[model samples]
Target chain A: MTENPNVPVLCATGVSAIVAGDAGDFRVLDGVSLEVDAGEIVDITGSSGCGKTTLLRALARLLPGAVGTLSLRGVSAHDLTPQAWRAAVALLPQKPTMVAGTVRENLLLPWTLKVRAQQSAPEDAVLRAALDGLHLSDVSLERDTDRLSVGQQARIALLRILMTNPSVLMLDEPDANLDDASAAQVTQATSQFASAGGAVIRVRHQRTDALASRRFSMCGGQLTETTS
Target chain B: MSGAGGVIVIGWWQLALATGLMVLTGALSVALKLGVAKQLAIATARTYAQLLLLGLVLGWIFGLDSPWAVLGVLVIMTGVAALTIARRAPDAPAGTTGISFLAMLLVGTFITFVVTGLIVRVEPWYLPRYVIPIAGMVLGNSMNGIALALERTFSDMDARSGEILALTALGATPWEAAAPSIRRAMRAAMIPGINTLSAAGIVFIPGMMAGQLLAGADPMAAAPYQIVVMVMVATADITGSTLAVMLTYRRRFGADDIYLERGYRPDSRS
Candidate 1:
């Protein structure tokens, strides 16, 4: 496998995962396959425990029990280091997490990672603009994240992942804790991301999002494309 | 019953008097319904048996004065100490015993050698009378430090799962993600030794100093020896804890550096 723009930005084939449960080890994802091209948004909707999150984790290489082929820009996942793979394919978990720091420090967390050490951090103006785009203009960067509401923290987490410039973004309910207005802003932000030649794959419990170029529904650990 | 160096040895009748103290303690526990009378009796018995066995073994080993015998005894002491450390930490992963053994063995031997060879400057340096006791002390102190540090590292990593996952998702290496937890663990492990150092002499006479005094060593000589013992123990504790943390923190992550969401399990040592 080699890097090529014409190839799908992210691809997975026959990915399966077995998560340990109280009862026993059980399959959460079974032989799921997907291909995502640049500048497209793919929405995955499913009931709770139906494996939407499992599929994203498998793609992100966060689940060691997950097995199958995963590749980015035609390069097999094995070709890239785990750090390199994760840097390019980032997975935002369901619950938003903020380190002990001010908003600016949280926003710059990705830059502090060793994988991103070589790259210069974004300027304060750039960060302010991004925060503004997310309807956080009223919040000061110096404000401690612990004081921020869960909704605001969620938005900051989304922006933090965006700052890393991942090629493919996998979000697990990015707008779960947000108000309608903030939720719309999150949609708009993702839309803007896809418009900039990035691919997005997100799990949503609500109806199919209009912004999604393709929609898929999962049931009983299997995924099927649905006509939108 | 007399020990070397003008030591005032306790007679069997005197030991019987100490046994009476334990019996009184057991009676008090029974009266208070503390449910510890049986355990106290067993522990008292074990204490007498173990100490007597230790005294006998040391007497024989001290007389041999062979370097191999001293080394063998030290290695065995380290092995037992490591096993105890591993068992003491309920949350540590399975291979913890092996790692603890290695950390204590290496750190204990190195510190003991430096203390005897350079500091105390024992001629031949393998005299069991000097080497065995010093090595035993080093292993004992380092064992405690490694256990505390390993336990803290595992528990802290488990508690800070969200932070760890966030960092790992953002492309941090396992070490990078665990550095904070390791720092806290190292601090937690080192605190006891630091406290001992600070409280030495003022709070209470330490075990080695008291032992020397009981054995009738000169107060001036015992003071310097106790100082060396305290400093060397602190050094061994810090170094052993560091090595153990460094070796074990990576176990919190899996193949491909995935944050083991379940954290580590004793059954899954690999």
Candidate 2:
């Protein structure tokens, strides 16, 4: 008898999603199933319009048109309150959104929400260290997010997600706008996170360096794992 | 000149000057992108002409010292102000414009009525000269504020929708997702009113005070009234605009994300 594939830290079974309209209902994922054990980095790569972003959104429970059984550690994504689902699974969108404020303000915004309000604020030194590890100076934290370069903004956005310490991180084209240095920072961070038992699911257009535990492709509205 | 009832002569040029002043202000507002100048000019002219005609009809009514006429005119002023606000904020939800207008009337009328009726204790009939002008000023300013607030609120929500969604995913409640945008829209709405209040005396003599002086009122007397009107206008504007923005936020977002209106293009109509 085959063991259940859904026994991992995060699982999406028989997932299907559509976008735009009911008439066409452009199917993005059909009967897609995936699993990520604790402390693994999974990469999803495919051509444009291959539904990579949609799959990530589905995992985050941010896609209204997505129909599936998505669960975190055996709890159904549908059963969890939106707040609960989001706090456990966070998605970093392709185009990082920066509110008009100081960099620190944007970084600390998630903590201000009632769901995460009880969490301790990230220490100033810890925040500064994250910025530095990402090759960003402490001065960058004081500057307005709008003033930062695109690469810096991307890293800062990722770092902000890290501050919340979500169990499952779903990233869509996170490295699309990043330069070599920022991209290196992202790889390092993901490696560190995975080693620490945090799971990461990311979508990329090209095969990225330093991440290949599990790879998948979306073709004809279905996800198929690519052989190593 | 008759012996018992004398002929009360008025200058046509004085009427022309007042009309010209109203037109000039209306035109200036349009040129400055404050509003639709031509429409405002027509509306102002129409209002002035109607007021003159109303004065003529009410001359006999006031002579009888009837309080009902005063009450009727006040109600008409409130209704017209409400309608104008409704028209200005059409992009808002179906009833939002009407709601904002009603809020404006409630705030403007409550303050003006309380101050004039209870505090100032103006005589019977309450003289349209005092009540009408004050009400018009308060209502007009509040309408602009509400319109601007509604525009800013919708536009800001549209622009910052991604951030709003991000917040929602980060466990922000719907209102929590919208709070930043709401605060920003309210602040933008208050800019004009705040600027006018801050620079009232130094920037330029406001129209009401200047008109009072031209109409033979003492400058000292007009100054106090102008100050009072400015204060009342600011209060009404802040109250109405803030309420309108806060109340309309839920309509802008969904349970899980920001709801983009179908075929909605940003600032396309504006």
Candidate 3:
């Protein structure tokens, strides 16, 4: 629980999910609790289908049936609109699909959401700054997204989330598609986000240099903090 | 126009010719072992019986001067049409039946009323002959469009659930997140109506025009009525699909903007 508003950017307690199946129902996660604070990176590792993604989804407010006491920025998720809450705790999926557009259109797609309709589109300077932070300074908005490599697409997806300036970033194996150089750039960018007082929660496939301050293992829908 | 009042009526012998042709086709199918001979005969029998019953019901309603009877018949027809459309969807659509019914009734009644009340200007607006026939035409056409639209909408959104979640994650409303699929559904539903509009005269004469021509109406007069009916049909199609999409897309996301674990798909999206 957020003992202080300045401490944890996001917290989930006793989070559980039961998905209905044809034969019967199955519980994916049970009583999993965690806290993510600004300027901190929490690394989660688990086997596929071990409820790692489910936990991230529950934290992102993307799973409606998930049961939990989850809060973002000390505000109960129930109190915030789904859109606003999701914006505050953005979840980046493993393989993100790119829309049909130039790199600029893909980058600015988040601004077109009705939740952001009231706010003006980010200025070109902001877009450039986001790209520059991700070591994509040479990339231009005019370039077609289709022309970009998988690594570039991964970087762009990261940049897209960073542009929103989400308080907590829940990344699900974001490096699975990234090359060595691209992975390095991503790690640097995430570290920068953490240093700038943003919370980073990531489920890593390989324990590369991700700069996580704490490590946790997810098994059978349960999370245990490890002091490795 | 002297003999146009009665024109030329089809006697029983000439009508029997069509029956004979159908029998011949059935025999040929039977001989060729197409396996559709029984189906053909059953369908023909069902169609004949249904139309005969409908004719009798219309005769009774037309004899009555009460608007209630006409409106009641229209309401029943709309319900039947909605059910038919819902059943026609590829997926198990018990959930969407009510929405489909609302969509069909709203669009079907609105356009049928506009045509019968304003444009055609029938003396008694709810007269059975005018109201029922217009409702039948509008409802039937829009029903197919709506079924396709609903099926497409459900399947598309279910398939694109990930994309939708991404948009939601980026602060997109359910409407914004599901816009592409909704657009696809609308276009899929409307394409047939639009094709009818595009192909009405050039490809071949449509049913309304054919009926008017057979009833001794002027060709030029029939043409204008055909245009009006097509436009009304298109309106019904567009309105029904749009309403269905608008109502159903919200179900993909929960009250708190979270993506549901299972949507319209029988097979889970997990």
Question: What are the runs in model 3 whose C-alpha is more than 4 Å off?
Answer: A1-5, A21-23, A123-140, B1-4, B23-35, B90-94, B261-270
lDDT of 2 at B211: 71
Tell me the tens digit of each residue's lDDT in model 2 across B1-270: 122223234567767877778778877887788867878777887887897897786676466555676666666766776677667766565567567756776777787776577755676426655666666677777778888888777767667767766777677777787777778878888888889988998989988898777666788988987887788888888887887777776776544553544322232222
Q: Model 2, stretches more than 4 Å misplaced?
A: A1-8, A11-35, A64-70, A76-81, A100-103, A137-140, A143-147, A209-212, A219-222, B1-95, B122-133, B201-203, B211-220, B257-270
Q: Candidate 1, residues B101-181: lDDT per residue as tens digits?
A: 888888998999999999999988897778888988888889889989999988888888988888888898999899888
Tens-place lDDT per residue, model 1, A12-35, is 999998776667677888899999
> Among these predicted structures, which one has the highest lDDT?
1
Better of 1 and 2 by TM-score: 1
Evaluated at residue B153, the lDDT of candidate 3 is 79
What TM-score does each prediction get for chain A alone?
0.96, 0.92, 0.92
Worst 10 residues of 1 chain A by lDDT: A17-26
TM-scores computed on chain B for all candidates: 0.95, 0.73, 0.90
> Model 1: how far is B244 from its true place, Å?
1.0
Which stretch of 10 consecutive residues in model 1 chain B shows the poorest summed lDDT? B261-270
Q: What are the lDDT figures for the candidates, one per model?
A: 0.89, 0.75, 0.81
